[model samples]
Target: MRIGLLTEGGYPYARGEARLWCDRLVRGLGQHEFRLYALSRDREQERAGWVDLPAQVTQVRTAPLWTAEVDGTWYGRRARRRFAQHYGDLAAGLCAGPAGAPGQGGYSPAEADRFRSALYGLAELAREEGGMVAALRSEEAVRALERVCRAPGAPRAAREARVTDLLLVGAHLEQALRPLSLDWYEEGELGSVDLCHAAAGGLAALPGLLARHFHGVPLVVTEYGVPLRAHYLGSADAPPAVRALLAAFHGRLAAEVYRSAAVLTPGNTHVRRWQERCGADRSKVRTVYPGMSAARFAGAGERPGGRAGAAGAGAEPGTLVWVGRIEPSKDLVTLLHAFAAVRQRVPGARLCVAGSAPDPEGAAYLLHCEELAGRLFPGDPPVEFVEMGGPAAPGLADVYARGAVIVLSSVVEGFPVSVVEAMFSGRATVSTDVGAVVEVVGGTGLVVPPRDPRALAEACVALLGDPERRDRLGAAARARAMELFTVEQNVAAFHRIYLEVAGRCPARRIAEADAAAPRPFAVPAELRVAGAGSVEVTR
Candidate 1:
């Protein structure tokens, strides 16, 4: 199968959110040919370079989202008029708030139709006009957006947008929607692919959206974290007008993507609920948990002494392990306070926090946690706040091996990856009930409400005090992780999905030919197939 893997801030990049998963997926499915369409988030990421791609990956095309140079493509007067009409409808649709327009929520049939028509109309215009760089950045585009914002019945916030707000929102829209102008839906690109698999929603799904629109390509979207939710959280501090417009635009886009895709796979039930709330069809959505490699932790999990309650297994007595990037969202404050309570119950208990700080904010948060730990446990604190894999801490598997109980205290989470790793290492876990924690834990371990130090401490003390329960839960967690969250299971599920989509929906390879595509396959009259798809008559 020829699969076009669409991504944003991920895969092929050495450092990215979804890079590891994409690399693993491609490597696992060596039978398929892959074409990568990536969007670089910044110059630093581009300079960081990409991971070594497998031989089956035939092409990689990338665009930047960090720069805003003039597109410089001039349009004819007639083309400008067409661009105005299409972009006008798109802008108006974006400005419509849930209260004003029926189609804005995309739940009602009429509203969904309104959203789809305006969206595809703009896509068609971009296709015929070569690119939208000039059109989207033109003064006329700003005027169009301004008119929508000021229009009667528009969102109240949008109607009050200042001139500066309009300009900023216009430029932001151009950057976010830039993928619509990319020349990817041609015979040699997405058109030839048997399936268009988007690695994320929103920006990552844009190319797949075009492919499915222009050609009859089937699309399958996999989202561990819904992009729409992220946008809402990230844009909270922006101007009210900008926030409203962007949110409405993204909401409509997500709904359309879900409706158009043949299948929607959310990493956990947590993500599935978010998508459903954003208007995704319940029948089309499936929950597929992210997969992890178990081999790296085999030494910790398979050791004879590693049996749950076994004395002298590598586990240090009364130690609690915490592993993940050190950030405020992890709520280390709550963890520290909870540990203080745990010490009262089990005086000899020790806490080990082992994870690197990925940014300055996280580094600052880590320092704050250290200070808080000191205040809680003064000199020779029972809490050992460590960063990176060094003498103070150690590698993740080593951290898990050193603890009888792994704890995740995050108030905000996606899939609780650290807990999964602990499970793979055959360790009992006490994690807060947030995001996918409950779904991932699946009755395998203890769960407590987030941000409750007393509750969290109590749960930890119970597991720590009972070695037999720890042993039982650890063994069960290890078994569950092996069965549901392993790479083998993930790959197998996607393999079946690909075959199902391809078997039912044939590739739209021929439609690109109607556009006078440059590929030899589009012009059989000028070339004769000599052998193995090679053209002998081409000049």
Candidate 2:
């Protein structure tokens, strides 16, 4: 099978979960040929360089999401009219509320069809016109949007949008809808592949949507994190008008993707709920958990001279370890407060925070955490920050191995890799009851509510004190991870799904194949009947 794997700031990148999972799939499923279609998030991501490709990877195609559309500065009168007609319907659709979203009822099936027609019409216009940038940025585009926002059927929120909001929306729509102008659906591109598998939703899934639209190709959208939700979360920084317009645009796009995709694979039940809320058909949605490399932590996971699985490979007796990228969402402040409580309970307790701040905000958060540690225990701070994936433990297993209890204090999370890594290391976990933590832990470890320092402290203290119980839970955790979350299991699940999806669409594909002149002996002797139908085969 040929798979067109679509991604954004993921797969084939030097870093990130999407890259890792894609690499694993390409490598593990050697029977299938993979063509990576990746979208670089920014200049830095493009400059970071791609990971080494596996033997099964046939080709890699990349486009820059951060780059401006290469617009040819001209549009004739007919072209202007075409753009207006298509853009008007698109603008009107964006002004309406998506089904199940808060607004004037929901976009009815008729409205949905109208939206789809408008979206595809614009896509066709973009292809015919060479690009969308010129028309999308035209003054008429803003006027069209303004008219739609104030229309009778427009959402109250959209109608409240000012001129600045209309301009912002028009600009954003130009960028986000740039996929409609791409030639990825042309011959020998994504259309040639047997399956179009989107590694994420939103922009990453756009190409897949187009491939399915143009070629009748089956699309499998795999979302480990809901990009629409991410957009909504980050939009809080924008003004109300800007936020409302972007929200409506993204919501409408998500519904279109969900409605058209052959299958939607949400990495966890946590993400699955988001997809469901975005109007994904429940029957077409599958919960396929993200796969992690258990081999990375196999050394620490080995049960040695123990009654049960202990964090035996250089495990410290009373230390709590938190491993991940240092970010505000991780709620390290709560972790610090919890550790302060742990210190009072266990006099000799210690903490080793192993992770890096991935961004400027996170770097600041890391420094703030250090300062908080100083204030919490000025005289002799037991909380030490160690650089994880160090030369001594390059695999990151040493970070998990060094702890009696693996702690996670994230208030916002999505199928946390740190918890799974700890489980693979046979280390008991104490994580906040957020996102997929409870689902991943599966009764193998303790889960406390987010922002509750006392609950976090109790969970961590329980694991640190009761070595026997920790050992049992650690064993159970490792077992569960192996059974459900290993790379092998993930690949196998997707492999089956790909076959299932493609199997259902074979007739359509076959119908599209060229029925050229038939060879004289095309029919076998045994199979050839004397009067099998009219017998006027194509010549």
What digit string (tens of lDDT, one per residue) describes model 1 on residues 1-539?
Answer: 77899999998898788898888889898877788999989999999999999998989999887765656667899888978887887788786545433323344566566767877777787788777787888899999988888788887899889999888888888988888778888867887877899999998998898898888788999999879989998999999988998888888889888878899999998898877776677877777778789888877777655443232258999999899999988998999999999999899999999899978999899889988888899888888866775576567777788998999999989988999999888889999989999989998899999999999999999999998888888888888888999988888778777766665663344444346653322212222344886745422
Q: Please, what's the RMSD in Å of model 2?
A: 6.1
Whole-model lDDT values for every prediction: 0.83, 0.82
Give the TM-score of each candidate.
0.91, 0.91
Predicted model with the maximum lDDT: 1
Model 1 misplaced regions, further than 4 Å: 99-107, 304-312, 389-393, 507-539
lDDT of 2 by residue, 1-539 (tens): 67899988888989654888888888998877788888887888878898999888878888777776556647799988988998898777776665554222246676667778888888877777777877888899999988988889777778788898788888888888878877788757877777899998888888888888888788999998889989999999887878988887787788888888899999899998887777788899888999888877877887555323565446887889999989899999999999999999998999999897767998899999999999999987899987654465444876788889899999899888999999988989999998899999999999999999999999888888888888889888888988989998999889778767755665233222444642221111112223848353221
Candidate 2's C-alpha runs over 4 A off are: 98-106, 304-308, 389-395, 507-539
- In model 2, the worst 10-residue window by lDDT is 520-529
Q: List the residue pairs that clash in candidate 2.
A: none
lDDT of 1 at 327: 91
